[model samples]
Target: MPMKVRGAPQAVVAILAFAGIVVALMQTMMIPLIPQLPRLLHATPSDATWAITATLLTGAVATPVVGRLGDMYGKRRMLLIGLALLVLGSFIGALSGTLAPMVVGRSLQGLAMGVIPLGISVMRDVLPADRLGSATALMSASLGVGGALGLPAAALVAERADWHLLFWTAAGFGVLAMALVLAVVPESQVRGGGRFDVVGAAGLSAGLSCLLLAVSKGVDWGGQVTAGLLGTSAILLGLWGWWELRTGEPLVDLRTSARRQVLLTNLASAVFGFGMFAMTMVLPQLLQLPRSTGYGLGTTMLGVGLTLAPSGLVMMAMSPVSARISRARGPKVTLMAGALVVAAGYGLGVLMMSALWQLVFVSSVIGAGIGLAYGAMPALIMSAVPIGETAAANSLNTLMRAIGTSISSAVAGVILANLTNAAGLPTLDGFRLVMAIGGGASLVAIAIAAFLPAHRVPAGTLPGREPSARRAVRISARPRPAERAGLPGEDE
Candidate 1:
């Protein structure tokens, strides 16, 4: 008789899903407060934007480090640590009355961004093989859902209650998530076998911080500072790459990252991230403008939020469809479809800005595109790299997306600044220009996807069905041992 098998705990999955939601919620919970920050904190627009910048910078630095630690120590423990940091940060922000302390708290809370990937790693340990793919897709979608759900909720709280209450609620959620994780999640045996490269981590942190700081601050700081920061960042990044190449156990395997599948997927992820944010940043402003402004639709905050909310719903609904499409046509094809859909959505936005429902339709279409793209990326990266490097590689891809968002923010600011109307309000013309640029960028991503090699296994095959074929592909597609030996073990 065949042996009976034990299934993963449903409670554990629930806790992990909740954890993903809370982490994602924190990412965009403050977005509604963006315009209000100047008045509430008595700061300039550029200074207030630091709240966003601080979180992005800290999250970017922490992601790869946390991923490496998850490999070396344990994902469950790392997840708990990240959640704890989030709770503490939220509490600190709630108590703060000034911008500086608030910025500090926001930066600390950014550590939580690493929790979802860590939780996904744990899910691999607990979830049955048959259910892993769907579970992974759901967890990935949770990130977008949490962000979308948090916005209106946060806006309502900020409007009716105190702004500080938002952070308090976040703190409460963090505590509950941590407790549930502790009670339900089991530890895994996936452990790293080498020393962690502190130097590489430091280099990466410095380089990314410098790069993001420049990008985030460039709108106010002008061309000289932006050029200088960008130049310094380039040099630091080059050095960081060399340091990783020579390190005993670097945080990221540069060689694996250099592989065609891994490299192109991450690059495409950056553009995907950029495209996603472009619509998000511009659309709300377009909807909330005064009707007299000629280009404004005069929608209320609540109305605007509701309209945008459906886009998120569309994204959630499309996750399964994206996975199915990926299975049938390969992830590369799904990715191209996603990029093209987003580009089409942007084109639609340019043509239909006057009508509120038209905006809603375009948003939903774009959200569906992002959902399809986001769901396929992790699977592609995981398939290409070794199991041990899974968290780090995935984290690096996530960081690329973050980098792309940061750059998009800068680019959008520049475009808006250059194209304001006579009343000092940003016009529909600027918004259209931004959307068109985003669409063009998505086209670039489609081209990249089109050129990607077709080496993926047919969907739904048994894992061990073609080891030799996988190895042969890996040999040709992966980097040489001489190139990767200093970084970490080759991807499985």
Candidate 2:
């Protein structure tokens, strides 16, 4: 059972969500600085990218590791550690005038990426069942919310002030959020106490690092290096999977992850992540390209940021709507509906991009779909897994989404690079192709979601209650029959 907390539930949700937004803001804070990093940090363009790549690689590795650690230790405790890393990273970044230290600070910021999934897990372990749906929905939406809002905020800062001030602002927000978490958020009493899986952690890290590095940098690194990295990743991951099955206490329990609902939800998450990121990649470039190109909107970075900001607000606004849909028809239906909406959004982008308003409309539709899909994902995962494995399970799902986005970034880069015009800039056709591909990927997610087992209300629950609502209550209540015999050594 979830531990009852003395603090108001609303305060807990707000603090955790704020922490999520701050970390997400850090991810995008450097976006406006990307083009300037070469000059500012005294590095070549190629070398400067490591500052961004460092964060991506570390975040991919950290989500699962810190999630497992959060489960073994306390989620709130681990969350504080993540926030501290963010603050420390921001401070270092503020002080750095060189590429090496900047990359180090960015890597530390990436380590805090586990905060979102950890926050969802914390909510699962403390909030009242009545509040879980909308609360988790909002928490999941925070990733998009922060990214959307961060771009405009970062853009304005980058345009008007010394870039160092951006990091200072991030540090200030981190400190405030950290203090609020300490004051308002309650530590989950639930614990999966066991010795840390050192070898498992190392193997998983090596595998993910290899895979993400190859995918993200393959365009710059050439075919041979990319192929070599990919092959190594495959071998490392294969061995890691084998070890996980045989080990007494694994970092991720393959058996639980293999459950039909968990399996399908993860597959859908990857496809959805890929589809969602394709929009981000295509939109800004289209917006910022010169209007002489006929297809370009001829806008500044700040304009691009302002245009996309509404989509973020729409995503947050859709949380309650997503929760209601999940409660009415089950998360399965919500996921399918969300995927279809995303596909429609991309379809609109491909068909109508001559005006800024059209792009905003396209993005807002996609963002709404993302909010719904993201919100439903945790409900699907948490419903399937044991309470003890909430953090690890959610972390794994988060990792899958990251992998999807990385793959999307690589594929979109290839498309945009190869299909350029006379000026060596990506043409309108390439942009449309990318949007069409995003639509196709969303369609694929719909197919995968179709395979998820229908949500079933627990036996002995009141029949009068909505099945999804009853299911949420059961998820927060005592273990169901399926979860009673969960992974070996799980606490009851």
Best by TM-score, which number?
2
Task: Summarize candidate 1's per-residue lDDT along 1-492 as a digit string, tens digits.
Answer: 111123345666667878988988887788878878988777888788878788888899999999888877778899999999999989988998778988989998998788877777666555554444455555666777787777778878877899999999999999999988877786666565477789988989999988998988876788899899899899999999998887767778887788877898889889878877888778888988898998888876666777788877777788777777766776777789889999999999889998888998999888888888877777667666665666777788888888888889889988887888888888788999999988988898888777665534355421212222221111112233565443321233
Ten contiguous residues with the weakest lDDT in model 2: 458-467
What value does the lDDT take at residue 234 in candidate 1? 93
Q: What's the TM-score of each model vs. the native?
A: 0.91, 0.94
Instruction: Enumerate residue pairs that collide in model 2.
Output: none
How big is the positional error of residue 101 in model 1, measured in Å on the Cα after superposition?
Answer: 1.3
Task: Give model 2 RMSD, 1 decimal.
Answer: 4.0
Per-model root-mean-square deviation over C-alphas: 4.4, 4.0
Look at candidate 1 and tell me the lDDT of residue 176: 97
Candidate 1 lDDT at 430 equals 92
Question: Model 2, 404: alpha-carbon shift in Å?
Answer: 0.3
Clashes per candidate, residues 3 or more apart or on different chains: 2, 0
